[model samples]
Structures are given as C-alpha cells and as structure tokens.
Target chain A: MEILIIILLPIICTIMIAAVGRKSVFLRNLFVLIPTVGDFLLVGHLAWQVKSGGTAASLNLVDLSNFAIKFEASGISVYMALSMTFLWIMTAIYSFGYMEHEHAQVRYYAALVLNLAAAMGIVFASNLVTFFIFFELLTIAVYPLVVHEETDAAYLAGKVYGVYLLTGGAMVLMATVVLYCLTGTFDFVPGGIPALAQQSTFMLTVLFVLFTIGFGFKAALVPLCYWLPEAMIAPTPISAVLHAVAVVNVGVFGFVRVIYNIFGPTLYNKMGFGSVIAVMAAITILYSAFQGLRQKEIKRMLAMSTINQLSFMLLGLVSFSMIGMTGGLLHIYYHSFMKITLFYCAGAIITQSKNKYVANMGGLAKHMPITMTCFAVAAVGIVGLPPVAGWVSKWYMMQGFLEMGKPIYAIIFLLSSLIELGFFGPPIFRAFFRKEENNSFNFQQDTSKFGSEAPWAMLAPIVIVAFFSVLFGFWGFVPHGLVKPALSGLLGKGF
Target chain B: MITNSWLLFFAVFIPLVSAPLSLIFSDKVSNRFTALSNVVNFLVIAGMYSAVSHGKLLVLELNTGFNFKLSFMADSLSLLCGLIFIAVWTLTSFYSIGYMSHEHAQRRYNLFSLLSLAGTLGVVFTRNLFSLYIFFEILSVASYVMVVHEESFEARKAGLKYILMGIIGGLTLLLAMVCTYHITGTVDLL
Candidate 1:
C-alpha cells in the first residue's frame, strides 16, 4: 500500500492540479506541495518499516503473461526514494519563487509532480521490466518542465534530449527483452542473479554493452554526455532537479540496478565488466573536470561537474568491493544534497541579480553573502574536503579502490577531486575576494521582485539542503543505518 | 482497458481529415480550429497510447487492390512519437500566435502545418514499407509548402533545394522498398 500510494499520489495530485489550477493558484500549489511532503513522510515510514522488519514491503499489482507490474522498497531503494522526495520538497519551494515570473505554472507544476511520481517509481521498482517502464515514464514526464521556457535553445536541447532518450529507451527495451529471454526472470536479487552467472561470457558482455550504452545516454557517460551540458538551457529549477534528483539520477540509479540487481556484484566481478565501466567512468570524471574548468556559465559548469560526479558514483559502485559499493550508495544521497544546494544557489543568483556567468560573479558574496556561503559549503562537500559528507563517501570510495588492489583508480579519484576544486573553488573565491565589475547592481536597493536577499522560498531550501550536506558529515552514523541494511540486504546477512 | 477498438486504428487519420478545416477559416479562426483539432487528435492518440501501453496492439490493415498491402501498427514507440508530436504542435500553435502575430499568410501556414503533422503521424504509424513510402511522400511534399510560405526568391530557392533533396531521398526509399518486397515478398517491419 505504501508503494501504491507513493506511485499513485502524485498522479492524483497532478489531476487535481489541472482541475484546481484554473480556480486558484494557492490550491494548485497546495496540491503539488501536499503530495511532496506526504510522500517524504510515507517513504520515511516505509524506510523505517524495512529497517526494523528486515522484510521489504512489496506490491504486486498485476501479472501480464509471465511478468508482473510490481514494486518493492528495499534499503537502498528506500534511501534513493527518500533522497528524491527530500530534494523534490526543496525543488517545489525553490520553484514557487523561481517560477513567479515564468509562464505555464499549471503545466510546469503538473509535469513536476508527475515527474516526482515517475522518479518514485524508478527507485522503488523491484524488477527490470518495472524499472524500464518507470524509466521511460520519467523521460516523458520531465519533458514539459525541461522545455517550459519554450525558447529556441530550450527546444534545441529538448530535441537532443528526446533523440538520445528515445534511442536509449529502445536499446534498453531490447536489452530487457534479451535478458528476459535468457534468464526468464526480471527480479533484482541483491548480489547477482545466480542463473545469469551460467550464461556465456560473450552474451553477458553484449548485454552489458546494451545496458550500459542505453543507460549511458542518461548517465551522460563521455561519448553520450553532451546532452547534459546542452540541457542547461532549461530553467534553473529544472536544471537543478534534473541534475541532482531525477533525470541524471535515474541514469546512475539505472547503473546501480544494473550492477547490483541485474548483474550482481559477484558475477559482475567474475565477468570483469567492472574494470571496463571503471575505466569509462574514470575518463568521464577527468574529461568532464577539464570541460567544467572551461565553462563560463555557472549552470553549465555545474552540469559538467554533475557529469563528473555521477561518474564518481559509478566508479565507486564498479570498484568491486563492499566498501566501494557502500561509498557509491552514500554518494547517491550526498551528491543530490550537495549538488542541489549548489544549483539552488545558482538559481537564486540567476533569479535575483539576473547574473549567470561565473566571470561576472566576482564580489557576488558581498551582495549575496548567504547564497555564496551555501555555495562554498556545497563546493567543499563536492571536492571531498574535510568535515563535510562528501569526504566520507570519497574516503570510502578511495579505500575501496586500494582494497581492490587498484591504486590507479584511487589516484584518478584524487586527481578529479583537485580538478573539481579548481573548477568549483574559483567561483566562491571570486565571489568573496574580487570586486564587483558591474557597479550598477545594488543589494541594498532590494528592487528585484523576489526580495532583498533572494526570497525566503528560494534561500531556505538552498540553506537547508546545504546544511544537510554538513549535518550528514557530522552525523555519520545515520548513513550506516541505511547503507549497512542496504548492503547486507543484497549480499545476505554475513556480508 | 485494453481494447481493439476501431477508433484506435484510424486515429492517425484525424489530422488528415482536419487539415482541410484549417483552409475553411480565416487567420484568427484558423488558429483556434487548429488548436481544437490538435486537442482532439491528442486525446484520441492519448487513448490509443493507453491501450498500447496496457498490451493492446493497435493495428490497421488495408487491402489496396494493388501488389501491396497497407499496414500500420501503433506500437509503444510510435505512440510515444504521436504523443510528442501533438504536444509540440499544440505548443507550436500557441507559439505562432505570439511569434507570427505580425506575419502574413497565417492561414496557409496553419493548413500546411496540420497536413505535415498528418504526414508525420502516418509515417510513424505505418509498419509496412508500402504505407511508409506513401506517408513519407506526403510528408516531404507537404513540408515544401511550409518552406515556400515566405514566397521570396530565397524562400523558393531553399524550398526547391529541400524538395529536390526530399525527392532524392524518397527515391532511395523506393529502391529499398523494391529490394525488400522482391526478396521477402512482403514489407512488414517484423
């Protein structure tokens, strides 16, 4: 029932939105807001239920032929669902302020809520077919939000996104069909599907290629990566949510499902698929870092940085060790919090001052001290600096690499961290150390539509998400409560 | 919810049927008509989409009394494209109201736009080379009017180049159709 309500609630809310939207803005906003908060509580309740009971909550809707439309909330999925819902709460608040001047609130909010529903479906999906269905739904649901601006650039990026995802979806469908044919099961067992281990190495390898290449379009893995940067033309809220929570997360989350659920860690290790993915992820990490350094726009830079960081999560997951997988899962939560914080800051800056370029953000801290402070904190978290949650995840990932007898991966992780600092550090520094090149803008004026300090609606989420990135750093045990159950749930009790 | 309802099969023809309605109205009225028709088209296609996703394969078979058969399948892939096309066309309808507010020949643009959309819908819906070739031809030719709507030397020049290239491409498609039918004695795409 938790699983059913989690998927159906937002869809119901979206219907209510279309009905209520024409009557009053407040009611429409309420329909969207209520479900987000409600979903977080419900998912939290469900997560707690799983943690305590040691039994996942499952929903079997129907059986189609030999397949079933089902949902289950395991430890890691609960963590992902929690992260998405939590980030959505922030996105909803940030959007209320950010979209004040924008058109199409009915369409935007509806798509946003529907997207929230689709994302929940992705995380809670217990099988490959169910995951694939929600995966495609997610792509379709986010379209209106991404193209909300209706500008030429927005459409261009939307075109790139559509073409890529369409082809990607078809590839994924083919792969799913092939896997179902080979093994006759779509259930995601924790370690590895034992039956899949008996398949020929060549068949499994090709299946891996199909799944990776298909999912890589969304994950923005190097050759399939330009769409992420191009997607920056969307409204800042869309960019933030897509980068942090929904769209890209779906891709990386697909990778998690592929590695753990579909391939399983042990079989994946034996097949040596982990090494190939790690190498690809390493290239993406380093290459995106360099690309990020050259980006002038803060959002695009964040976009590149996102491509870099998502690979970090992938690298960790494919690192072929328990600690590595743990690090990967932790980063999924950490990255969303940190990245959303950074994006919310960027959105606030873009909205308040009408400034977007990093080159112009010099002395920005003087004007928006609160925003830059949040940015600084998130930047520290992203680069794995001490006393932040990012450090905890990165430390584990590096340790996992070393434990696996792969010092080179550890070195690659270190190098990307420095490059990330080179990219992220400058904006925060210039925001403080340098002088405002444009003197006409005045924070004291408070003339913008939002407020003197980027409306509370926007700033609050940024500060809150940023603060969580720090809180998780200090309250490290909280992650263990989740990750241990998740790891053990998949690998069995002894693990 | 899954049904082999006949409306689901011929739903692609809704646009082709409405394309002429745009020519019957003036500029202001045509925009609204286009919007209305597109909404109707969207709702029907959306219904088709629901049926397809729920495991109903919406197929249309035609006996043309020639050496060829016309086959159309609204698989999930085509339905997705159909849905996207309608959404984009609806958005484009709203967009043109603002962007083309000052433009002339709005009626001509509106008429061809629906016709081209019909063409696209046909192309996406068909599962056989026979129908695909016929729809592909409609799409290329209908698009010519849109390119030449400006009615200037450059517009005509570009339109000519576009149509010529489109024709060449169509011919290549025909070549492929011939090869497939000659070999398989049928043009069904699986």
Candidate 2:
C-alpha cells in the first residue's frame, strides 16, 4: 500500500491540477510543484526504508492465477525512482518560470505530473506485466505533450513517435508473452530465469531479437531510430525529460532488466547476446556522435548527442562484466544530471535570447555568463576529459569493456569522445573566445545593459543539477551507493 | 461469464466487421466508429491476459472444409502482440482525427486504415505457416493502399516501389512455405 501510494500520488495530483488549474496561474503552478516535491519526499522516505531495512517493500494489486501486478522497492528500483523523482522536481521548478507566458497551462501541468507517475511506475514495477502497462501508458500520456504545440509539424512528429514506439512496444509485448509461456512466471528474478537456459538456442535467439528490437526503439539503436531527433518538436522541459530523465532511461532500464535479471550474465554469455548488443551499441555511439555535428539547432544537436551518449550505458550492460554493468548503471545517474543541466542551459538561452541556432550563438557569454559557463561544464563532463562524473563512468565502462576482451568498444568510446568534443566544444569556444557579434539589438547587449540572467526559477535548477555532476565526480557514491546493491544483484555477492 | 474462447473470437472478429463499416459511413461518423472499434478490440484482448497468464493457451480452430484448417493461437505472446497492434491502431485512429481532418477522401483513408488493422491482427494471431502466409499477404495488400492514400506523385511512385518490393517478399514467403509443406507434410508450426 505504501509503495502503491508513491506511484498514484502524482497521477492523482495531475487530475487535481487539471481540474482546478484553470482558475489562476499561481494555483496551477502550485498544484504542479507540490505533488512533485511530495513524490520526492515519499520516494526519499522509501529509499531510507530500503537502505536501513535492507529489504524491498512491495504491494500486489492483482493476482490472476500465475501472473500478478506488483510494485517493489529493490535497490535498482529505488535508485532509478529516486533519480527520476529528482529530475521531475527539477523540471517542475524550471517550468514554473519557463512556462510563465505559455498557453495551455492546465494541459501542460497535468501531462507533466502524469508523465512522472508513469515513469515512477516503470521504475517500481516488479514484474514485466506491470512494467508493460506503465510503459504503454507512458506512450499515450506523453503524446499530448509532444503534440502540445499543435502545429502540422508537431502532429506529424507525434504520428511518427506513435508508430515507432508502439511498434517497439509490440515487439516487447511479444517477448514478454513468450517468456511467460516458457517460464510460467513474469516475476523478475535477480540472476536470470533458470528455465530460459533449457530452451533451444533458436527459441532463445528469437526472443533476444524481439526484446532487443522492441527496447531498441526508445534506446535509439541506430537502424530503427530517427524519432528522437524529430521528437524535439516538443517544448524544452519536455525534451529534457525525454532526452535526459524519463523516456530514454526507461529504455535503458528495460535493457538492464533484460540483461541482468532476465538473461543474467551466465546465460547472456552462453547465448552470445553480448556480442550482438555490443555491435549495435558501438555503431550508435560513433554514428550519432558524427551526426550531431551536422545539427544546426542546439536542441537537435543535444538530441543527437543524447542518442550517442545513451549507447554508452548500453555498451556497458552488454559488456557482461560486473564493472561494465556498474559503469552503465552509474552513467544513468551521471548522465541524467549532466544532460539535464545542458538542456536547462539551452532552454534558458532560448527563453532569454531567442537564440535557437548554434551558428548565431557566438559570444553569448558576455551577457548570460552563468548559463554559458554551466553549459561548458556539462559539455566538458560529456567529453570525459576531466575530473567529472562522465570521467568516472567512462573509466569504469572502458575497464569493463577491456575486461570483457573487447578493445574495439574502448576505441569506439575514445573516438566518440573526440567527435563529441567537436560538436559541444564549439559553442563554448565561440561563447567566450570569439568577439561578441556587432548586432546592436542582440539580447546579449540588451541584457548586458541590465545585467540580467535567466529567471531564478530556471537558473536555480540548472545550477543545482550541474553542481551535482561535478560534486558526484569527487564523491561518486552519492548515487553510486544506491546502485552497488543492484549491481551485486547481477554480479553475485562481491560485486 | 465470458469464456476465454469468446474473448479470442471477438479479438479477431471485431476488426473484420469494422473494415467495411469504415467505408460506408460519413466522415465524422466513420472516424468515431473506427476509434470506438479500436477501443473495443483493445479491451477484448486485455481481458485475455488472465486466461493467458493461467497457462491456458486459447486455440480457436476454424474448419474451412475438405480437410483444410485455419487456427488462431492466443498464446501469451500472440495475445500480447495483439494488444500492441490494437493499442497502436487506437492511438493512430485518434491521431488521424487531427492529422487527416484536412485531407481529401477521409472515408477512403479510414477504410484502408481499418482494413489494415484487421490484416495486422490476423498476422499477429495466426499460428500455422499457411495462415501466417495468408494473413501476411492480407496485411501487405491492405497497407499498400495506405502508402498510396495521398495519391500525390511521390506517393504514387513510392506506392509502386512498395508494391514491387511487397510482391518480391510475398513470392519469397510463398516459396519457403511450399518447400516446408512439401518436406514436412504439414503447415502447422508445432
């Protein structure tokens, strides 16, 4: 019951906000912010309970003979839930200012909260059925957000988004049903389903292919992806949740559950799923990096870079080594903070200066110094070039890949970093290094006259999440401690 | 007091009924009608989750006559996949409300989309290679109309390429099915 409340609170509040939000802006924003903060507190309490007691708390909503819908707070679920809740809170705060003058406040606030609920449901689900239900709901709930702009282009993007993700959902559904028929249970066991090993290699291979392609859609695997870039038609906060926090990581979460909990390391090795996933991850990593360079829109470039960076987590999981999985899991947290910061900075820039194109953003630091500096910090962290969160996760990923006897992945990582720098380094270089453009009406000049920065609502969250990216670099265990027990769940006791 | 077979039966039958219905109705009526049909299809399949999870695989056999048989296999996997197709189709139907409101021939578009839905459901639920091949062709043929629904120059050209590739695929599948039937003396998979 306690666990269930944590999931339902945001949804209930979403309804409340939608119902009463039309009255006033302050009340509307309050309804949105209160639930997010409330969910964060509830999740924090749940995390404390899990950490102190060392056992998961679960609630079962339905039992239909062999299949049951249950939500549990295991180490992995707790970690993901906490991270998602934190991002939701940050996004809500940022939206308070970003959406001040925007229309459709009621719809926007409702969808935002509902999206958080669906994401938390994904994190807390103990079985495949629960996860699938929430995952499908997520597809529907976020559609309104994507098409919120209501332009012809947004509708077309929404259609493409629906086709791609639901097709992926279809494949995932196929795999789930097949696994249930074979094993007679949908509960996620820690170290793989034992019965799965007894199945024929052909059956196993078919299941793997279905699961991979299904989850790969949102994970942005190379061949089956183009929707993520197109989905940037959404508003910035929604894009942050899509790219940094919720949708993409849920896809990665699916991969984690599939690899560690469904197939486990032993079976994953025996079946050689690692090599298959590694090849896909390697291609997406470098390909998206090079592709990011061609993007002129800052958000689209970040979207492409997101597609690139997300593959690191996938490669980490497919390495099938403990350190690799740890790195992958930790990167989920590290990347969330870093990427959300970058997106927040981008959003602030857009809201403040209306500078959407990177080519026109030269010498932006003269006015928006804090925003550009935060962007630079995040950009450096993404390149893994310094003593930051990205470096820590990258070191572990490289070590994991090398230990798995796949040095090609290590090379891919190194090369993608160089290419990553190529795209992200320019804005920083142009911001501070180059002279400010001579346009008399540039926002930089106008804002410089008043010494204005982004509104406090937006600037605070940007600074906070960016600060975490650097803070976590020095003290890795803040998020890492949450992940260690989950890693051990896959790698046996010592890990 | 619905039996598991009823659920399986309606899951396959509703789309068949809606395909023609989509063609006859006025634009507004047909849109709502197709959207309603999608919802009902999704509900029927969701109800099958219990029986499916109970490990009672719902197999409905249709006797077409003269020792020929067609079967719909509602194993957990097929049922789940059925749910996916219905769900996507439902959302797309709603999306089409906003997307196709301005386009010409709304009735025709609704008709082909609903027809393709039926065909896709057939492909997802069929168990035997013979039935799978048949429904696969049904899906390909129905969706080809959608690819060319715009009837623009580019849509026509793409439709031509689509039909060409589809024929090649259909022929390859037919050859494989024929070879397997000849070698094994049966078309059912397991």
Candidate 3:
C-alpha cells in the first residue's frame, strides 16, 4: 500500500500541474511543491524502516498470477532511492528559479517530474522485465527534456540519443525474452541461473555477449559511449540530472543488478567471464580518461569523465571479491555527488559567463569563488583525493582488484586513476592560475555583467551537493547493512 | 467478480479519465483540469503502492477480444517503475509550466502527455505478453505526439522516423509474442 502511494503521487501531481499551469502560476507552483515534499518524506520513511532492520514491502498485483508489480527497498535499492530523491529535491529547487526566465515552463516541469518518477522506478524494480519496462520508459521520458529547446541541434542530438538507447533496449528485450524462455521465472534471485551453467557453453557465451552489449550501452563502455557526449546539448539542468545523476546511474546500477542478482558471484567466478569484464572495464577507464584530456568543451570533458568513472564500478563488479563489490556500490553514491557538483559548476559558468570551453575560464576563481571552489573540490574528488567521497570507493576498488590475486588489474586501476588525475587536474589548475585572456572577460561581462554568479536557486543546490560529496567522504561510511545482506542472499557466501 | 476488479479499472481509468475531461473543457480550463486529473491519478497510484507495500496484491482483469483475460499485477518490480514514473512526471509537470507556456497547441501536448502516462502505467501493470504489446503500442503512439509537439518540419520528420521505427519494433515484438504464445499456449509473463 505504501508502494502504491509513492508511485501514484507524482502522476497525480503531473495532471494537477498541467491543468493548473495555464491559469494560475501560484496554483501551478503549489501543485508541484506538494508532491516533491511528499515524495521526499515517503522515501525517507522507507529508508528509516530499512535502517531499522525492517523488511522492505512488496506489493503483488493479484489480477495477473504471473505478473507482479513490486516495490522492495533492500540496502542497495534504498540507498539508490534515497540518493535520487535527495538530488531531485535539489534539482527541483534549482529549476523553480532557473525556469523562471525560460519559455514553455510547464512542459519543462512536467518532463522533469516524469523523468524523476521513472528513475525511482528503476531503483525499486525486483525483476528483469519490470526493470526493462522502466529502463525503456526512462529513455522516452528523457527525450523531450533533451530536445526541449526544439533547435535543429537538439533534434539531431535527440535522434542520436533515441537510436543509441533504443537499439540497446532492443538487445536487452531480446536477451530478457530468451532468458525467460529458458528459465521458468524472471525474478532476480541471487546466485544466478544454475540451470544456465548446465546449458551448452556456446549458449551461455552468446547470452553473455547479448547482456554485455545491452548493459554496456547505458554503462557507456567505450564502443557505445558516443551518445553520452552527444547528449550534452540538453539544457544545463537536464545535463546535470541525466548525465550526472539519473540516466547514467541507472545503467551502472543495472550492471550491478545483473552481476550481483542475476549472475551470482559463484556462477560468475566459475564461468571465467570476470577476467574478460575486468579487461574491458580497464580499457574503457584508460581510453575515456585520455579522451577527456583532449576535449576542449567542459561538458564534453565531464561526459568523458563519466564514461571513465562508470568503468570503475564495472571493474569492481568483475573483481569477484567483497571489497570490489562494496567499492563499486560506494562509487555509485560517491561518483553521483562528485559528478553532479562538477556539472552544476559547468552549468553555472555557462549560464553566468556564456563560456563552454575550458580555455576561456582563466581567473574564474577570483570572480565566482563559490562556484569555482565547488568545482575544484569536485574535481579533486573525481581525481580520488583524500577527504573527498571519491577516494573511499576508489580505495575499495583497488583493494578488491588486488585481493583477487590480479596484481596487474591493480596496476591498471592505479594507472587509470593517474590518467584521471592527468586529465581533470589541468582544467582546475588553469582556471585558477592562468591570467585572464583579453577575450575571456569580454564574454563573461557580456552575459553576466549584472552579476558574476548564478541565482541563489542554482547556486544553492551545487553548494549543498558539493558539501555532501566531501561530508560523505569524511564519514567513510557505506550503508551496506541493507544491500550487503540482500546481496549475500543473492550471491551466497562466495561474494 | 467484475466489481472486485476495481484495482484494474482504477489502473486504466485514472489517467484515461483525464483525456475526455481535458478535451471537454476550454483550452485554458482543460489544461488546468488535466493537471488536476494527473494529480488525482498519481494519488491513486500512491494508494495502490501503499496497498502493495502492505503485502497486498493490486491486480485487475479485463476481457479481451479473444476469450482471454488481460491481467495487470502490481509487484515490487512494477511498483518501483511506477514510483519513478510518477515522480518524474511530477517534476516534468513543474518544468512544463515554463516549457509549454508559449506553445500554440498546449492542450494537445498536455492531453497526449497524460495519455502517455496512462499507457506507461498500463505497460507497468499488465501481466501478459499480449497486454504488454497493446500498452507498448499505445505508449509509442502517444509519445510520438510529444516528439513532434513543435510541429515544425524537422519535428514532423523526426516524429515520422520515430513512428516508423517504433512500428518496426512493435511488429517484431508482436512476432515474438505470437511465437511465445504458440509455444506456451498462454501469453502469461511469469
């Protein structure tokens, strides 16, 4: 019953806002505020329950014996749900003022709500079919938000986004159907399909390929990563949410789900696929970091960085060790906060100074100290510096890799970290140290002559997220009581 | 038996109710009304989630053209997806206040967006291959309107391509569904 309310609240809000938006601004804003607060409370309650060792709730649809729409908050799911809701509240607060000057405000708000709802659903789903349904819906829900600008560039970007994700969705759907056909059920029980291992090795390998390609597209592993960079044409807020928090996170989260829930650690170890996955992830981490170095566009650089960071999670997953899985899970939260902070700063610079290239950002630290400081902190975190959230996860990832007796993977991990630092460190260094170019201040003054910083509405969320990025690191906590046990249930003691 | 199936009716009717209600009102009034309907619909979903979270099953059955019953089930997986849909829709609504303010055909966009929600939820709740296909098509068609909301030549082109590709995908899915049904003698998902 609680699960139904969580799902229904937003749909009701959408209807109310769409209806009220045309007539009364007060009513429109009121309708939007009510549900945002409600959802936050609802998720908070669920988190508290999970923390108290209470079992998460599951709602089964009775009309269909074979079909069940469920909601269960395991440690992992609760963590993800809480993180999403937290960021969303901030994004909502940011959008209230950011959209004030924009046209077509109603559509923008509606899409935002729809995307949030879809993201939450992805976190809570317990089966492959249910997850796939929301996964595809997420792609659809985010498209309008991407193309909200209605420009030719936005359209083209939207097309690329559609093609990449839909093709990936097709692959996932096919694999899901095949898996369901072979197995009687599609539930994500831990320890994977034992019957699957008994099948022909050739069939298992084929299934593995299909699953990797499907999951990899969202995870942005090398070959399928172009869409992410292209997707940067979206509005700054949309970019922050989709690239930094929601859309990309779903992909990595799905990867975790597949590995921990569907494949199970013992089955994964027996198949000898962990080495293959590890190598693939290592290559992506190094490749994307190098690519980040060559890019001039700040958003593009960040996009590439996301591709690299996501691989860290994948590497942890394939590590087949406890430390590795924990590190991977920790990275999800760590990376989300850090990346969102960077994106917020990027958006601030662009919105305030009309500059998109890093080359033009000299001496920004002097003019927009708050934003630049936040950017620097986030960059440091991304580089895996101490006292920031990123290091905790990166350390665990390294430990996991080393524990597996794969010293070479540990070397690759360290080398990739250095490469990450190599690309990310320079931009912050240049932004603060370099003398302002003659043309640099021209654009900065042209757009933001009225003020050197973005509105409080925008700045506030960045500051909050940046603070949490550091704070979570200082705490050095991984809320694994919920997820770890659930994972144990799925993977057995081998995990 | 039919009366006990209120959950199924609520699942389908909550958002579906908004379409006619939205269309009936004047453009300005209908938009607000549609927003209200969406809010109400989402509230109903929240209630459904509550029911499910309490360890109850929210299921409904509808008669199909062929002597078949279309089943809709609310389990943890679907509830999760449903939660996300409602949440994102809520935020997007706030965003749309600013985004859709100036569009000429505001009513049309609002209507289709709500219908898209209905179709999305329909897909989330349904239990069989056949219903999944039906709702999937509905979602595809409804969202196509949103893709072409601007009605520019470029928007139209994109929409056409999207529709065509969707049709191809749908046909492929239909073929797959038929194959499954042939093999199993029923299209049940579980």
lDDT of 1 by residue, A1-495 (tens): 988999899999999999888789999989989989999999999889877866788898877877988888888788788888988988999999998878888998898899888899888888888898988998887777667789898898889888888788888999998899889998887776778988998889889999999899999899998888887888888889875568888898898888887888778877888888988999999999999999999999999989999999998888867777888888888888899999999998887777888888876876787788799878877876533566557766775776677867767776777678778866875675556785635454554423446878898998899888877763555555688777776665423
Flag regions of model 3 displaced more than 4 Å: A442-450, A478-483, A489-495, B1-190
**Candidates 1 and 2: which is better by lDDT?**
1
| TM-score against truth, every candidate | 0.71, 0.71, 0.70
lDDT of each: 0.80, 0.79, 0.74
Worst 10 residues of 2 chain B by lDDT: B62-71
Can you tell me which runs of candidate 1 are displaced by over 4 Å? A440-444, A447-451, A493-495, B1-190
- For candidate 1, give the lDDT of residue A416: 78
In Å, residue A494's CA in model 1 sits off its true spot by 8.5
Score residue A233 of candidate 3 by CA lDDT: 88
Per-candidate clash tally: 2, 0, 93
- Clashing residue pairs in candidate 1 are A191-A264, A192-A264
Which segments of model 2 are wrong by more than 4 Å? A438-445, A449-452, A490-495, B1-190
lDDT of 1 by residue, B1-190 (tens): 3233555455667777777778777788888888788888888888776678787777877654233456677878988988898889888887877777678778768877887887788888877876676667668767877897775668767876886677556544654554454456567884
Candidate 2 per-residue lDDT, tens place, A1-495, comes to 667777788888888898889987778778787778888888888778766666678888998888789888888888888888888999999998888888887898899999888888898898999999999888788898889889999999999999999999999999999998888888888888788889898889988999998889888999877999889888899999765679999998998888877877789877889888888889999889989999999999999889898899999888776667778888888889889999999999887877787876766777787788789878867876433467657756776776787767777877787678779866775674445566421354356532647889999999898888866764554676666666765455422
